[model samples]
Target: MSKETMPAAEAQSYELAFHVLPTVAEGEVAEVFQTLKDLITKAGGELGVEEAPARFELAYEIVKHLEGRNRKFSSAYFGWVRFTVDPAKVEHLDEEIGGNKSILRHLIIKLTKVEEENPYFFHQAMAEQGKSETIDLDEEEAEATTATDEDASESETDSEVTEDKE
Candidate 1:
C-alpha cells in the first residue's frame, strides 16, 4: 500500500462508550469489536484502549427462553472504546452501526476541544488556583475570629469593673 493509503498505526485519539445486547455471548465480543475496528480503519483511523465490561441487571427481559432451557435472561453488557477516525468519515460509521445486530447501541462522537486536552494538567491548574483561594479565605476568617474574641474580652472587663464598684 502507498504511504497515504496504508492504515495509520496511530490516529488522533477518541473515546467511545459502547453497549452490547444481553443475549450476546462474552466469547463473541472480541470478533464484534474487531468488526468495528476494521470498519474504522478501512475508513482511515486507529483503535485504542478497550475498556473492561460494566454490566448491570436489566430491568426487563429482552427475549424469553424455552420453558426450561436456560435461566439466564436479565443482564446487559457495556464497555468503553477509544479510537481515532478520520473526522470526515464519522457519519458513515453511524449508518454502519445502525444496521448491525450485535450492537444494541453505539455512538461515535467527537471529543470536545476541552476533553481532547489533557485532564491531568487542567485539574492541577485548577487545584493550584483553589489552594490560593482557600488560603485567602482562611486568613480572612482568622482575622474575623480574632476581632470577635477581643470584643468579648473587652465586654467581660467592663462587667468586672462595674461589679467591683458595687
Candidate 2:
C-alpha cells in the first residue's frame, strides 16, 4: 500500500486492511494486530474500528514469500482497521505492514472522511444466519394463534348446542 503521495495535514484518515495466513493460531492473532496498532501510533496515526479476523478463501493461490521462505496458502484470516494519522507517515505505515511476515496481503486506502454507514468489513453472514433462525419463532407464534382460534370457535359451538338442548 505504498502510495507515492501523502499530504502534509495531520488529520487524514485511512483504512488498513490485511489478511493473515490461517496457519497462525488464534492465540497468536492478537499479537499481529497489536503490532499494527503500535505501528500506526508510532507513525502518528490514531487507531479506529478494528474488523475482527475471519476465515475466508483467497481468490487465487498466493505463494507467499515463495522466492525465499516459500509457502502456499489457500485461505486466511482477514482483518481491517480504521485509523487517522498524519499524511506524511502513510509510506512508513505501508512499509511496516508489508515487512511483517505474518501478513499475507495488505491494502491501505486513504479515506476522504469516516462515516458509520459505509460497508465495513465484518462477519455479516453469521449475523444473517442468526436472523434466519429467529423466523422460526414467528412461525411458531402463528401456529399457536391458529390453535387458540380453533379452540375458541369449538367452545362457542358447544354453548350454542347446549342452549338448543335446554
Candidate 3:
C-alpha cells in the first residue's frame, strides 16, 4: 500500500466580506460582484452561496485605504461571498480585491471546516428582529424625511450666512 495519509485534493474554506462604496450605483454593484465571482473561478475556487447586498452604517469612518489612496467613508453596501480555495492562491485574491476601487473594504478568513450554509444567515435572522442597521421605510415616509432634512439644511445655511455678516 502507498504511504499516503492525507488527501491531496483538499481545499481551504474562506469567508469573504466586503463593502462596496455607498456612492456606487446598484447596477455597478452587480457588476463588481460578477467580476469577483469570475476572479474566484479563474483562481480555481468554488463559489458558494452569496448574500444579498444590504445597507449598513460603519461604526467609524474608514480613513486608511489601500495603495496610496486615502478616503473617509461613513457607510457602505455590504455583501458576502463564501468559497473554497487553495491556500497558495490567497495572495492573488487579496491583490484582486484590494486593487478594486469599487470595494471600500474587504476581509478574507480561513475557516477551520467546511460550512455549506449561507454565511450571513445569522445576520439575516437578526435583521428580521430589528437588530440590524438596515431600515425599511415606506416610500412616502422616506420622501417626507428627505423633505424635512432639506428644510433643516436650508435653515442652517441661512444661519451661517447671517453669522458671516455679523
Candidate 4:
C-alpha cells in the first residue's frame, strides 16, 4: 500500500479595521494595545497596523459638556487600529467589539479581489487626470480667445472700410 499524507487545512486571514474611543495615559499604551491584541489573538488573528495610535485631529470641537465630563472621568481620545485575523475568528472578534463601548465603531469587510485595489493608486490616477485637464485651456480661456479673435476681425473690417472710402 502506498503511503499518502493528507493535505494541510488552509486558514484564510482577514484584515480588520476599527476605532478605539480613547488612548492610554502615559505609559499605559502597552496595556491598552496588549488588551486589544490579546483579545484579537484569542480570536485567531494577528494585529496589524494601528494607524495614528494617537489622535491626530479633531472632527469638531469637543462640546463643553462632553469635555467637562470627559475631564472629570478621564481624557477621551479617538484612535484607529487594523489587524489581520482568521475568517472564522472574525465573528468572535466582532461580537467582542460590539459588546465593548470603548470601541466607538468597527467595520469588518471581506477583502475580495476588486475591493483589494489600492485607494492610493486610484487617487494618484485621478490626480494625474486632474493635472492633464489643468494643462489644457479651460472653458473660460477658450471663450476669451474666441472673443479676442472676434475683436481683431472687427478691427480689420473697420480698416477695410476706411481704405475703401479713401
**Which candidate comes out best when scored by TM-score?**
2
Q: Clashing pairs in model 3? A: none
Q: Count the backbone clashes (under 3 Å) in each candidate.
A: 0, 0, 0, 0
Count backbone overlaps in model 2: 0
The residue ranges of model 4 lying beyond 4 angstroms of the native Cα positions read: 1-10, 23-26, 58-82, 113-166
Q: Write the per-residue lDDT of candidate 3 for residues 19-91, one digit (tens) a residue.
A: 8888888778888888888888899999887785567788678875645877788888888888887767877
Candidate 4 lDDT by residue in tens digits, 1-166: 1111223333443444444455445455445546666787787776554543343234333432233464222234334454555455666677876565454445665544454443223334545786787554344576543434434544656555443442
What lDDT does the true structure give each of the candidates? 0.58, 0.75, 0.72, 0.49
Model 2: per-residue lDDT, tens digit, 41-130?
Answer: 998878887777778777667887744787888899888888888877788779888998789999998665445337464667656776
- Higher-TM-score candidate of 1 and 3: 3
The worst-scoring run of ten residues by lDDT in candidate 3 lies at: 1-10
Candidate 4, pairs of clashing residues: none
Ten residues in a row with the worst lDDT in model 4? 1-10
C-alpha TM-scores of all predictions: 0.50, 0.68, 0.65, 0.44
Pairs of residues at least 3 apart in sequence or in different chains that clash in candidate 1: none
